[model samples]
Target chain A: MSGPARTPAEPATAPALEARELEVRFPAGRGRWARAVDGVSLAVRPGQVVALVGESGCGKSTLARALLGLQPVHAGQVLVDGAPLAASRAGLKAYRRRAQLVLQDPMGSLNPRMSVYESVAEGLRIHGVGDEERRVAEALGRVGLRPPERFFARYPHELSGGQRQRVVIAGALVLEPSILVADEPVSSLDASVRGEILALLLRLREELGLSLLVVTHDLGLAWNIADRIAVMYLGRIIEEGSTDEVLGEPKHPYTRALLSVVPEVGRLEPVVLTGEPPDPAAIPAGCRFHPRCPLLRSGLPDEVVTRCHGRALPVLPVQGPHRAACHATDRASADS
Target chain B: MGPGARYALRSVASGLGTLLFVVVFNFFLFRMLPGDPIGLYTRGRNVPPEQIEALRAELDRPLLEQFVTYLANPFASTINSARYNQPVWTLIGDRVWATLLLVGTAIVLASILGTWIGIRAGWRRGERFDRVSTGVTLTLYSMPEFWLGMILLITFGVGVGFVPGVFPIGGIITPGVDPTSLAGVLDVMWHMVLPVTTLMVVYLAEYALVMRASLIDELGEDYLTVARAKGLMDKVVRRRHAVPNALLPTVTLILLNLGFVVSGAITVETVFSWPGLGLLSYDALRGPDIALLQAIFLLFSIGVIVANIIADLLYAVLDPRVRA
Candidate 1:
């Protein structure tokens, strides 16, 4: 057969979920707001898996929330299928049905008092979906829970960590959302179970053509399953590209520092970033990541160092499917 | 037996043992209190030597023998009230149902209203309704029961000359009224309003506060975020996901409150002069009536222990994790 033809109703090339110049802020105190997610833009294409990698407070999760319309965006818009998200009640509800969220802790994410069936069927019941029984069972089956009846009556605590996470996924799948935004989904699971969950996500994307936006702090997770990677530092995406391109040849200094610490089997020289990420409320001027950038301290040319310390960096295009927001990289490319 | 069954059985056995200790302790402690029941019964007037001798013989038995006899036939009306010239159990039996009715009604009302308020307050935390309700309930909770009862009694019972009183000042019903008739029933309930209101106001805050605190804790849980992410309306998230989990700890609190129902609220009952166990205990304290006091203590302790056992069983049923 030839390549799949686009349906007339929905443009095939449209992204499943997209965010443009998204910003999320929380009131810090004393009339000051801390920007959790600063002017950022991203997109999850139909049937592709994108991993959003960052440190603990880097706002990858915030961006994920914004994508699902769970968080109120302070600035910019989140688009679904190339259309601006509607702010009306009915419109928001319809949008929510197209996007769903999976949280970090499986143990804490499922109501311990509710049975697996109740948990899985909750979303279906909320959106007033019909044929709930078959839908719930089918969702569970797709999540690798065979004969879902065995788990129908069991509470969350009765299940293992892996099974609980599968139930959480089943809860998400029951809605049949096109985009599944998972925030550190496997961070709370065992190492053995983490692979199984990641594989399940990959398998779901393949079978259902579902778009996935996975937010995580683990570089290894991005390498394992992501088709593309976006590295966020202090609420900004510093690097974006295909997984192999970005991980193999990191153009952004923050991305390089992050990848340097991912314990490789044979690599000896590991670059360790000194100092913590600056407080978001008091983010350093110029590049937000310049405070901890190792390249800035490597005795670069005086002009390059001044630019790094004083000027804002734009996401400059590198070789195919790769971009980074760093002045040092620009200078290096110019010199070469 | 399974471990859960064994655990339940063990709890029951321990509860029964505690009840037994309370019984012995109550019996002995009352006997040791200063005051002679016989003297109180006779009103310090001259009494025939034979009658005095008989009263002493009935009450002055060796503590060990009395306890053993009580153990052998605990339900028998062996203990007599010092002032009433009747069995202590019989007198308590008359008042126990009334006490239960008043306190039971209060507890039921408090739980339903309190839990509802808590759910609302916690779900929309920091809203005006939450702030106002929390403040009002806390103020009501802090007021003394007797003081609150007196205030209700005065305002509703002894209104200003222009505005007449709406409720009775005290008593369970009008004196010498036929209790079975509709008019009598109305009278009893009318009198019940002040005392019940006092108890309800105080207890309502407890439940509301506990439920609010517990529900607030549950609301912060990750499950609730997942529930919201499921596209559920705010109310649905709270009722389906948050309430059940929050209600777990509150269950134990509610059951314990039910247990306290048997004893009745002494201060409120006294302020109303309601013929309940609390009033009976209060009077018996003045007479230093050992038999009556001991009987009331026993009933109160039994209520507490039984309620606790029921709570434990319900907890296991509600939370599967506790079954282990």
Candidate 2:
């Protein structure tokens, strides 16, 4: 039952979060600039969830931090609700009030001295929201802290692992923010509890019209909750499209390898990648995924090698508006 | 025994062991020196046979026999010093309180002033204020306490003629005033200035530096990041979450360091010639005061042991994480 087939709440007029040609690089010990997030451009509409999935050093957290103005970017602008994030003092303050982050490690993120009620009420007081009493009560209620009276005064140390994470989520929601950048939010949770938090986030999205940028390494999160998917590797996005397209018919070789690794509900032995992902700091020059591309066609027909290793890498379109970054995908398209 | 009582028992046993060794070693070693307490008692004067015999009986008791007697009766009828014909406990009882009040005030002032500067500099991180704090703390931390005392003496005691002389410098009270009088109390406080400041500047630097390091490290914790991400002002994020968490380790350091200063503050008193435990112990180190030396050693050991215990108990009250 679709439960009355409630239409997803309408998204806001302007994009919730947008970044143009975002590039971040650090000065190497030897005077060269090492790229972290190279030419990464993304947009998340209000009330829609977009999952950024990648291996550890794919600049996922860097991207998340820049969204919150925690990290300074070298080239490009991050706009929150149509205003530049770092334009001026007033703009920064305005951006902070609208965009919030749900951190990864719930246990480490909740201060032991803060009670559940105090932690939830903190954000409301910061943004100068409605009555402290009613808002904190409502937030705890939404997070499923049943008989909210029991947990309202309890410290973080007293709560179980799952409960601590729920309190963290409540803290973010109390501010009534427009966009929540959940940076690896559920990665540190147990398998049984991860689903509950993911569902809670999805429910909050629908009921509140909040945008979500869920940075994760799990394909399951993308499949379960994301409307769109962006797959990154070595600090660059290799694929982007609807969730079904990326999971059902992955376009790039890297995207294909990532999907092959997901463990099905009743299946055993998830597919293993042949090697660890390349270091982001020293990404391969031409087609960064060339070293591990299973479909590289080792004995390339000279023509294809000349193009792929020589200079030009092509873009190919796959199912449902999917875009893949590879010469192999282009060659495959011509062969088909 | 309950947990607290067991810990207390452990502490007491340790104190008794240390005292036993100090008393026995000082008793034999001091007697082995050139002149004996009996000789000093007579002052090379001819005394009646019965008086000499009474003094010898007191001195001839075996070191272990005398020590065991003292342990059994720390508070029991006390022995009289043959040199002064006064109760040994009575002399100790008179001096110990004055020393504690003076040194205790110095340590408290140092910790409060040090912790405040440390938190301010640490919260600001990399600013001109932070740099100034580092320079000042390191400079003052390395300056020896006695040298600082001498500098104060030259400036305030002699040059400016603020105070009359150096003999009563930073001590209990002037020789003529009765300690019960308000004037006498005021005189003691006046004397405390040089000694308190000398030790305060010397040790406050170490506290500020140690606390600064701890505060900087705690500032990187995930909870503080989460606090910042909650749309809270930077000031609130730093004051509420960062400062208290950082101060936890500094509390333990403050406790251990207080014990060091109480015992280590001798240099300041030595330079100033103040009549406190530091000056008293230095005189004992010279000669003709074996019993006094042993008594002072015993008291210093007890003060250190008590300070450590207080540090342990303070843990539960300061950090909620520890109570759990």
Candidate 3:
């Protein structure tokens, strides 16, 4: 039940995985491009859990894929241990061995035809690692599938939803990767089983010093597990900081709107902003969130309001412990 | 009993029931043709009045008695053919091996070639090779089988300017070759080249198109993406993860196609004049040879039913989900 040790402001260890100004674009039919993941930078320190929280279509999953090198990067760099990711095939294979991805929808993720043993042993076979039997058995045991031999011949369809997700986790963990990029790892599971899978992930971090980059839209999940939180809007991180700082005192109106919906004891009424979700293809001019900003309607000062409607915001600065990109927040901070 | 065994037992029982139904149906089908069997059997033959009376006495029995004799031994009970005066079973036996050789070889070759083309085309979908192969196969698939056969017959069987007739125009083998010797076997295969090619072209198109479509569906499955993310090579992901799953539907189609091999391609056989069951059936229809038609119908039904049973059992082995 106890939390892991707090991450130091200046940790001696380098980030296990980091994305520096990553951008990913997809062709939107006729000549136009959809900036799916546009100009986002974030880092996951070794053994630290960082949650990327955002609504659907905010490019959180695309950013996760870009970090894993599964999606081609349009711009910026992905670093591992303070060095940029290697470019050669052999280097990519080696990088993949050190980092792995656990996808959402375990029912769809695991191959129905493959037995549990073969599925877990896949990475080992790919990398040509020896002692496969013992490694696969150990990975299964780590995921809490007791007496791994019992599960060796079992298929994905034969297992329960939670058990299937565990098998997927076992498949990823079999490689002994230093970091795991889990994309909504439990979003498709039943409500009762979500906590167990999240706890298993946290336990793996403690036992193996494995860094995790968990992507989800559930603020409750981030509050329960993540050491830090990054809230994204329209393919950009609008607010990011230690979980306590960002959740306790959210600065951006979008973050506040998201937090307002999480049911808690004696909290203010939820902020229901009236606007369609931002479209990545045609992001509005000025601040992308301006069209939907509750504060703009709540009556900000004239000059700050003008900036919100006329000027685009820059990416979050690297120096601050907590940072938010909003003209209203800048004005409030300046006044205080 | 295990689910697999139970499934096999059920499939085989149903197949046998269908065969029994075909047996009873074949006997009555020809009798209802509104022509006298004696007249059909004795056409153009000079015979004494007493002998004709005797033949009628034997053939014109009560329907129940005839059915009993048929049920006793369906194959041997058939009347001698009016053309060759040989028992229908013996005539059928003579042609069985020839037909099997032609159809079996075509099926095997087509399956291998078509499945390979399908895998490559589907894996690199939308590429130039995929587009060309898919378009070609689809066009071939839509062509009439008999039309394609005739085209091959004219082009390869008969000589054109500067291109000598490379293969024999018709028949299974040359007249002078020793039937048991290596030369004879070679001659038979050489003669088979045209007819087999004709069958293969039509069949290959079917397998390739089905396999291509099946694999395209499997390509969008999540397991393939997971396989790629495991650091496996691209080819490995396709061969190990995608193709095995994709082959499920294609396997069913291939096995069902095998069921029709015994029937033989009637039009193709007639065009080539290959001495197979198909040619026998064609000759029988001209005589309206009631007895021979009945026996051939029964044989074709048996072949198809047995194949359906095999397909069901093999499917259980190939896809574990079917076992349960």
Candidate 3 lDDT over B1-324, as tens digits, reads 987789888998999889888878887887678978888888898757887798788778998898888877887744688766888889999999999999999999999999999998998998998999989999988988788878788887787777777888899999999979999999999999999988998889889888888999988776676666778878888888889989988888888888888788888899899999998899988887777887888998888888888889988887777777
Per-structure clash totals for the candidates: 0, 1, 0
Per-model TM values vs. the true structure: 0.91, 0.80, 0.91
Report lDDT (Cα) of residue B249, candidate 3. 81
Backbone clash total for model 3 is: 0
Native-referenced Cα lDDT, model 1: 0.83
Error of 2 at A149 (Å): 1.9
TM-score of chain B of each: 0.93, 0.80, 0.95
Error of 1 at A99 (Å): 2.1
In angstroms, the error of model 2 at A40 is 1.6
2 against 3, candidate with superior DockQ? 3
Model 1 chain A weakest 10-residue run by lDDT? A1-10
For residues A183-282, could you state the per-residue lDDT of candidate 2 as single tens digits? 8888888999998998899898889988889999988777788888888877777787777677767787777667777765223234445654677567
Model 2 C-alpha RMSD vs. true structure (Å) is 5.7
Candidate 1 per-residue lDDT over residues B81-184, each given as its tens digit: 77686898889989998899899999999889888888788778999989998999889988988998888888888886676788888889899899999999
Q: Rank the candidates by DockQ, best first.
A: 1, 3, 2
Superposition error at A197 for model 2 (Å) = 2.2
Best of the candidates, lDDT: 3
